[model samples]
Target chain A: MDIVVKKIVREVKRGNQDAFAELVDLYKDKVFHIAYRMLGNAHEAQDVSQEAFLRAYTNIESYDENRKFSTWIFRIATNLSIDRIRRKKPDFHLEDQVSGTDNLDYHSQFAADIDLPEDQVVKLEMQQWIQDEIMALPPKYRSAIILKYLEDLSLKEISEVMNLPVATVKTRIHRGREALRKRLGQA
Target chain B: MACTRDKQQVINQYLDEEMTLLESKQFEEHLHSCPDCEKHVRELKKTTAIIQSASHFEAPKDFTAGVMDRLPKQSKTKRWQQWIRRHPIVLTAAVFFLVFVTSLSAGFGAEEEIVVRGDGHFIINESERTVVIPEGSAIQGDLFIRNGDVEVNGEVAGDITVVNGRHLQASSAQISGDIEEINQTFEWLWFEMKTLWNDAVPFLTPASEEE
Candidate 1:
């Protein structure tokens, strides 16, 4: 997959604009999920995800092919997500007025493997509750927690994406989970 | 005494799979003895699990096309900036020529006093540090004014650069080229560097190639 992605990146660097769509297709869900969970709004997440792909396309020349592409793109999405989280008023996402159908859109987008409707709905509510808890933490801890667990990045990867030391990333994840634990007790 | 901080650190490490086998073994043993740590670890595990289990969403179907649409077409400002970056030598030389011509036309003897260098316009108030081109007047070349406020009520055919000063234009004032005000030290240094670059990089192209 890395080889395939590198081929596409080379094409993009050579001025093949359409070739960037493949990269967008390859990493869209991962990028969108990180931004979605980080900003807690589907609309903003979608906007940020699109922006990440556009930036990756424009700056494809700067990308080092030897390194992992996921880390590079993930770094861009995470930084944009944190910026959006910090610059906005706190009252916004609490009401989370991102279209009435954001959750519905998620359901339709992932409706492929619905084994049991009853079990899926309960699990989805639990997931939503957990997402709300993630949004409640400060932006720094929220980014650390989401990247570590939701995005499945290692401590080293999170450190790279956040441009912090590995030890700092570890501390952030610890404190973030501690906060999540107390908020999650209602479940 | 409960080692809560140390145990808490390992809980996150353990959940993240960062613990080595030896650390994992010791932590498991510790959890067996410490009910408080065990419960805390249990809840934290559940939280992280829920996070990992959260559903992922695909970008909207039109997202790629949307991005392609908004991919910036270089604006006029960006184009000039790119031109400046691509041919720094030519721009510096052009700036050097400009300063040389300006100082020559303004005359060496007019230092600190009012010196307005243009083809032909009117009014220099040396006492007030002001120059005025009254209505119905026009200058054929670039205007270089030093340490003086300028009021242009007429038209000029070339650039207007005010050194360590400011320029005000009347409603009827017209300039065919750029208007530059150099009062800050940073812009002054840029002006100086352009003069130097003109000397060093004249081989790249003529000074007018910047246009």
Candidate 2:
């Protein structure tokens, strides 16, 4: 996967749309997932994802191949999501009633369809619960948690993505998890 | 025993898989004996799992095709046009050429005559050649003349040299240098309207015909 991405990146640097298309295909899912998780809306996530890819394509020359392409794309998506959230100035109180329904339904339906072991179901439910908890977090904590877990990025990668220091990323992740645990207990 | 603050650092390194095997084994041993640290690890793991599951999202169908449709088609002609528009030298040269042509055309049709930068020392040798220097004039350099007559009722700071001119005239004209004259007739007329008019349109109306 790394080699393929590197080749596609080279082609993209040369201004080849087909190469860029391959890259887009390669990471579009992950990018959309990150944006959706960060922004909590499908339409906004899609828009943010599209904008991220467009920005990446236009500025492909600026990308450093030595770094992970995934981290770079994730950074773009995450920043765009943050900007969109800031612009919306969404009232947090109403977010639960409005945004939680679709996700809750999706999780419930998936749970019903997937007849897994007891432990797996518990894990899946816990995962869904954590996601909802993350959404309820402040934007800063939410980004920290998403980058640390969903993207499975290192502290260094999270720092690069968030434009923060490694120590800051670690602190955010630590505090974010603590907050999630507290919220989970209340739930 | 209260879990030491160092336990948090240990947990962070453990989560990041940065600890060596011996360190991991030591931490695992510590967790086995400490329920508080064990609970912390479990909570952290659960939180990580939840975030991972919640973040799963799919891209919209035809996302790539949509993006490709919006991108401007790159072609050689388009690139060339954009390059020319952005190149500073090309743009500057184009603007200079336009200004030069416009100024040249405008100068040919101008009516009011004005001595832009020359000195007052001048001569006219042609049959109807007339020169007009306005009043309160100051010439800092020398002026020369050929086969045309001149009328300087203003001032000349340098030498007035004439050669084979018809008429050499100066009215209250100051010449700082020598006034060298060749084959030409000299005249001093006070308020010479014919000479003034003839000088105004020297090429059109010759002085001899006007006189």
DockQ of predictions, in order shown:
0.31, 0.32
* Chain A of candidate 2 compared with the true chain A, TM-score: 0.78
Pairs that clash in candidate 2:
A127-B50, B124-B148, B124-B149, B125-B147, B125-B148, B125-B149, B125-B165, B126-B147, B126-B148, B128-B207
lDDT of 1 by residue, A1-187 (tens): 9889889888677655557778887888889888998888889999988888778877887888998899999999988888887788755333343466655433344447546698778887777787778888998999998888877788888998888999999889878878887877436
Most lDDT-accurate candidate: 1
| Alpha carbon lDDT of each predicted model | 0.80, 0.71
TM-score of the candidate numbered 1?
Answer: 0.56
Tens digit per residue, CA lDDT, model 2, B10-79: 8978987889999999999999999988888887776566556563667989988877776658898755
Question: Taking the tens digit of each residue's C-alpha lDDT, what string does model 2 give over A66-160?
Answer: 88898899988888898888899645542243454653433333334646899988877765656567678888988888877777877888899
Alpha carbon deviation, residue B203, candidate 1 (Å): 65
lDDT of 1 by residue, B95-188 (tens): 9999976754453233567667789867998877899988899988789887788999998888898877789999999888889987766676
TM-score per candidate, in order? 0.56, 0.53
Q: Which parts of model 1 are misplaced by more than 4 Å? A: A92-121, B1-3, B13-23, B73-211
Report the Cα lDDT for residue A161, model 1. Answer: 88
TM-score of chain B of each: 0.43, 0.33
For model 1, report DockQ.
0.31
